[model samples]
Target: MCSHYEGPTADRIHHAFGIRPDGPVQTDLWPGHRGYYLTSGGDSGGLSVSTGTFGLLPHWAKDVKLARRTYNCRSETAAEKPSFRAAWRQARHCIIPAEAIYEPDWRSGKSTPTRITRRDGGLILIAGLWESWSDAEGLQVNSYTMLTINADQHDLMRHYHRPEDEKRMVVMLASGAIQDWLTVPAGESAAFLRQYPAERLQAEATG
Candidate 1:
């Protein structure tokens, strides 16, 4: 599962969002850090961007630390997992705009951070789930997690992670299909969980 990434700049995001989020956009993101997520505004027929913690914060969560382990939700079990079930049932899907994602490559008997980006040099619009939580003062807080599918047989993504671990990659949404993914009924989510076509991505060792 991915834990680090480079996010799009505020200007780049503004072009897509029509406005920038309130503060500075984070360039490097990790679990528990702040980042931006896009959600479908109920009646606007458009996306609304919001800055929130990178990890998903379920209503029952006592603190934001849960984000560390909840950064990447496994697609196979997301609907049944406690940490992600509510968002799944609510169909709180979102797209995380990333410049690139960093993952560990363990090919040489050692771990080296590898950078993965789209071959076309466009933003990698990662599929995710977002949830809102209420703090002690009743203030609303938002958080999110990326959705991942098994990538063991993928030509590019399969090379990531340790050999002993199951390889997985985040689901990437195409621009044309973004609206469909955001508004589709929960039962149809499986249709959007497909692995991006092989070789549509490129990777290089960043460390």
Candidate 2:
């Protein structure tokens, strides 16, 4: 359940080692990449979409406003869902840049927000899939969702809370793994769909 994120880099500064506000809404609001949207909400946590602006394209979708609800695609069934199946097969691949990602620790009495970042201050390339939806106006919009995998021993035992019921986090790919992740066959990529080692990541409590 990734919702909040932050990006404070120049729009033209593509592929830097920091979070950048680029994606569907940025394209709609700023017009650039046809696929991807950046979210800095505490819940969305800065994601990259695969489509143009809006997330889904109904067979009868008549307006772009419908997109506001289709921002996320569940990883468990994404490959089987009609809405995401096609994109998952051919039109997938996006880089969700983030400086840090937040997760809640409920046991702390208050909902303690922890900021998880790379130890060396590098960007975390969250794996994503995109889709293109067209409205009655023939305007195409792209959107995306991050994939999640079960938490590893490190994230479950250290970075995240213990007794973690639904221990899950976005599938963050390393910089060196991004190229293979983006171009590999979907079936083969599933092997790469695992939690990043918690040792290489650090989580700091945030205000």
Q: Could you tell me the TM-score of candidate 1?
A: 0.96
lDDT of 2 by residue, 1-207 (tens): 454544324443245634453342331221122333332223444333222542454445466555555545566777887767776776366656666666776666667777777888876667777555665677765556567666645444244544456566778887777656666677775776777877788877786
What is candidate 2's CA lDDT for residue 2?
Answer: 51
**lDDT: which candidate is best?**
1
Q: For residues 37-151, could you state the per-residue lDDT of candidate 1 as single tens digits?
A: 8888778798888888898999998888888989999999999999999999889999998999999999998999999988998888999999999977888989999999999
Error of 2 at 39 (Å): 18
For model 1, name the residue pairs that clash.
none
Q: Give the lDDT of residue 125 in candidate 2.
A: 69
